[model samples]
Target: MQHRPQNWILILDFGSQYTQLIARRVRELNVYCEIHPFNKDLATFADNPPNGVILSGGPSSVNDENAPNINEDIFNWDVPVLGICYGLQILAHNEISGSVEKADRREFGRSELIVDDNTDLLKEIPEESVVWMSHGDHIKELSSNYEVIAHTDNAHVAAVRHDEKPIYGVQFHPEVVHTVYGGQILQNFVYSICHLKGSWTAKSFIESTIEEIREKVGDDRVICGLSGGVDSTVVATLVHEAIGDQLQCIFVDNGVLRKNEFQDVLDIYEDQLHLPVKGIDASDKFLERLKGVVDPEMKRITIGETFIEVFDEAIAHDDSYKYLAQGTLYPDVIESISFKGPSATIKSHHNVGGLPEEMNLDLIEPVRELFKDEVRNVGRELGIPEHFIKRHPFPGPGLAIRIISDVDRPKLDILREADDIFISELRKNDLYDEVWQALAVLLPVQSVGVMGDERTYEFTIGLRAVTSVDGMTADWAHLPHPFLAHVSNRIINEVRGINRVVYDISSKPPSTIEWE
Candidate 1:
């Protein structure tokens, strides 16, 4: 992947979800950057050089003997360098030592960043600004050459910088929104140090991505997996516009969809968009393979494996197809940064996982460079419908993860109907778009209830609706008591087997939006 001699930055990924976010922030500054594995050669960057470099946070602890690390040459690259989270830990280890591990007291949430009032890094930020900290280890000691530039209540070395060098490190994750001065910190690195011009926008990304797509794909046919999610839909649309009708989208219905989702997705993606989309109704195949599998992890693995088989078989006859286009957004790339380290939440969302190793085709990830909001901006540029652009977040596993206790069709259908009513009422009450995501889960727990003179034993359905800027952290939607009452009544009255509905009011940390 040889990028042009443009204003480029290189993001050294240590497998953190914030890696792509780091790149997105850079690109937002109109300075193009590419993410590479830390083990990749750092010297090639000497000639076709990036203006600066950033090291991404990872899921691994710096104290772990086998933790992923960047080559030391990164510090000597003669350019500005920024290290984040595990990136900071690795840097501290490479130079300094004794970053104490506090596994029992990991800094996993918001913290106040106590910065040196005169420091350049905290240029625009206040001295004691709030920042997101998510690491288990802290710098107990620093290298003789490095100095502590920032601190927090718990960790003395929240940030470090070599006095004589351009390299810098921050223990807290400045890429997340929880960090009050995160964007300012990133801007200081980009504008003040690297001096990158903030000229990049969604328009620029679209034009450049289109040109790149045309250059690589040429006359070859490309097959995209359209999930009807904003990321995939935008990617499919952008590719179609780039190559005209050469891109074929194979949408597989994995029997884990929401109520009437199969048709709704097709209608919006196929008919409305006028793209070359083929709806492969492989619901039965997926359902059969998934029978009696109740474990959430097992369900994801099986669904991912079977989806490959289904997608592979669906496009096997199209001999001209040589590339697989995915709607993989910046978050997807950032979230699965390690490619090996699974998410902390254990909830497999936004990922279909990696394709089979022997798929033998190149991957076309058009929107892989844009964030969720940036993708929507590009969608607006491409004339996408506002409703489609602003739709609520749905898990990549579809409805499989929402059903708490079972994966049977009868239970799935019931869950789907109950979920539809819940969401529809949210819409009718003008509260749908306000929430980040809303879903009804079928609980395995059964309870006795009386309805119309008969006693019934049925599963419970839990409803969750949240409001968030992105899926990273969310707060429960504040429903008017009357509205909640109306929604509860509709689900219990209209959807059978669900005599009870409970609303979840927890945030993302303690409770993920999904029940399972």
Candidate 2:
């Protein structure tokens, strides 16, 4: 029941950090799309070409030696090609003898776009609209087939279109949220230019996923590592509906969980949803294995390996559970595997690419294709309570990542108490939904504080709250000053942690949402 797309758009990634943003925008219009490397052989997609092809912005200059390029056959595919930033430069270099010259001044932030052409791509966009620009190269000359459609004050050839072809190019990034009417521009391209219908929906996704699970997992037992998040819970719900009692849910208490989260989630799984749920108390085992480990990636690997080992050992006698169902989302997949195009590893998600090779289990990711927001939509469609579905995303390694330097019981206790207070206060103030993710990171550096009359030294906590549509891009939440003062004072007074609590004001480009 995976709703067959009326038309598909293929986005060739050119190493741009914002490549996924383009795909997200297209998907928002309910059209299907896929991302592939720019260097993929043109022959690979010759027979089955997409309705449109988008060239993503990248870090490399077109004039650089051995720059990334697509085969000349791509232009002959009879598909609309939209080039963005470095993308436009590449097309200029390949299609004509035009060279991408270094700009006198680089455009990094918001810029004014003067749209001279009311063509299909920029049909409804205002003439003097603000756009997000991040590029150092500019196309001064165009081929005979192309002409300037729009320009900024610095970028003369801000946008161009082929005379009689569907090819188009833009210097500014319309995919980012910073660009006004960005989504609407993408909608015009998909609906007006490519004629792609907005047919894909949550109902279609749910039906398709249930059908897929039923077909692929016929008569086989599935062991799912349920984290009680929206991702895993929705996956478990979908699989349970498909395989019924054949699916077994394993909830591991890895010691680094939120305050009182284990019993709360377990009760919901067992009594509420009525799934075959089992709890594993491996806190001591996990803590003992992670002793003295400090590196973030190393901690992730150790925690991931340990989880697999625990699962393998737990199900050693039971040979029926041959498949491992995970709640791996689209952001996790893109971060882990999409960076290097076809096969590359970024940061490993515990349930995704981090699993050891020796584990004899096949993965069944029911919600892997959906983003965080889409997953929440599916969960809502399945009747999950808003309170549960709206919970902020938690890492699989739990609070270990939030504990900056080392992992220990004392640090865990301090972090947990502080985190509980922070989250409880957010919920109390009705600001929980205003942020995508919020956490208290226990910094290794200790600060001096005066309690009553004596001097005390303890750990400092970094409070982080970010707002994002998808986990790909984010901006730090600007909580009220009174809220911050109250939370800081309460944490210093109630939790026996550090004296100072600082808020993270940085956004995603310069800083990640998490301190680690």
Q: Pick the candidate with the highest TM-score.
A: 2
Cα lDDT, all candidates: 0.77, 0.85
Per-residue lDDT for 76-125 in model 1, tens only? Answer: 66889999988888888877555546545678898888877446777878
Cα RMSD of all models vs. native, in order, equals: 4.4, 2.5
Clashes of 2: 0
What lDDT does model 2 reach?
0.85
Highest lDDT: which candidate?
2
Weakest ten-residue segment in model 2 by summed lDDT: 337-346
Worst 10 residues of 1 by lDDT: 340-349
lDDT of 1 at 369: 56
lDDT for model 1, please: 0.77
